[model samples]
Target: MNKTVWIVLALVAVLVIGAFSGYNSLVNMDEAINGKWSQVENQLQRRADLIPNLNATVSGYAQHEQAAIKAVADARAKLAGSQGVAAKAEANNELGGALSRLLVIAENYPNLKADQNFRQLADELAGTENRIAVARKDYNDAVQIYNSKIRTFPSNIYAGMLGFGAKEYFKAAEGAQQVPQVKF
Candidate 1:
């Protein structure tokens, strides 16, 4: 081959290799982000599933606390209706808020707090919340990695061309500000 033709071919090969490397990294990062999001969803689902049993345990003790019961119901309904990740996170936050409210109500009933069933469910719910928090933090961290990659130099170019998008953070509601205080 002529010298000029050889140089041009080598340049083309270099560009193709760089682009493929960048694209593959972005794709892997995107998949990792999605997998982290799925983990968060499963943890949240665990919390949601536990709520009903929690409500029933508390209900048997605090029958007259209609407002607390209603809060839990409303939160669950909101969670059920949520569509996207952002919406689901918002709804989950609301549910956490409602759960916190119910726990506060439970505080007024010493008998309920002392009940073995209530205590057991409370422990389970607390563990579930911890798991959810860990999952959410991991998800947000994954999103950050993907977003950074999609915004930086060559990776950014590949990300944009391949339609890689930024993701939202998973945040807790205002009421999820603190852990529920459980007294035995």
Candidate 2:
């Protein structure tokens, strides 16, 4: 009888330990997802901040390109006010298209392209875009891992009990699969 009781106690202790370990792991993964998302937001904010200066430089040389300038401004505002991953992704695509048009208009003015300030701003914007791409990839990767964990055995049970839900991925906007046509 004593041996049976000892064996039962050992099993109970093991189960308790396993439960604590699983819960801690889920919390860690959830926090990791939040950190990765913050990085994506940081990169996005960097790009948003760069837009005004870029628009100013382009406008000085291409004064007649008011429509393109306004488009970029409007897209930037939309991105700023956007709340979720999907909304931001859409706004970002709009901003990207606007920026492309603005750049093309700048191409018509050799002076704008050659200006030191414009050149520097353009390079910085390019770098920020690259950063944003990397950040988004990182965030999506985290989301994938978290989602898989919450759908798998053992962890799934803990996740459901703890109210941990799946996170959304930062997906590319529509029409992004099409190749853009460039003209000289």
Candidate 3:
């Protein structure tokens, strides 16, 4: 074979290898984003699952706190039915607010606070909330990495060609950064 033919073949081989590598990288990043999102969803579901038990225990002691209980239920339903990451995050924020109200109601009832089951459930919910926070952070981190990859130069070219779009970060809903007003 001519030297020119050999050089051309080598160039083509290098390009093929580089293209394959880029495509694989995009695939891995996309999968990481997807997996992180699942973790966030699982943690949210765990928090939602604990709501019923928490509400049931609190209801027996604070019958007058019906509004808070209803709010939590409504928020949980909304979170469960939410479609995308943005919608789910908004719904989850609403649920967090409702849960805060429910906890406040419990504070008014000494008996409920002292109850063993209520304490355990509250502890579990708090732990679940922590998990949700960690999961959300991890998910946002993964999204950041994936989004950066899709937006950056060389990867951006491959990402666009491969249809690897940017992933959304889990952001706080509007007014979430403000200090919540607590009234007596």
Candidate 2 clashes between residue pairs 3 or more apart in a chain or in different chains:
none
TM-scores of all candidate predictions against the true structure = 0.90, 0.92, 0.93
lDDT of 1 by residue, 113-132 (tens): 99998898899889988998
Residue 136, candidate 1: Cα error in Å is 0.8
Local distance difference test, candidate 3: 0.90
lDDT of 2 by residue, 1-184 (tens): 6999999999999988988998888889889988998898899899999999999998888888999999999999999999988898889889988998898888899999999999999999999999999999999999999899899998888789889888889989788888979899
Query: Which prediction has the highest TM-score against the true structure?
Result: 3
| Model 1 clashing residue pairs (backbone) | none
- What are the runs in model 1 whose C-alpha is more than 4 Å off? 174-184
Worst 10 residues of 1 by lDDT: 171-180
Alpha carbon deviation, residue 145, candidate 1 (Å):
0.8
Better of 1 and 3 by lDDT: 3
Flag the better candidate by TM-score, 2 or 3. Answer: 3
TM-score of 3: 0.93
- Quick one: how many clashes does candidate 1 have? 0
Residues 1-184, candidate 3: write the lDDT tens digits: 9999999999999988988998898888888888988999999999899999999999999888889999999999999999998899899999999999899889999999999999999999999989988998998998888888778888888788788887778998789788989899
Cα misplacement distance, residue 175 of candidate 2 (Å): 2.1
User: How displaced is residue 43 in candidate 2, in Å?
Assistant: 0.8
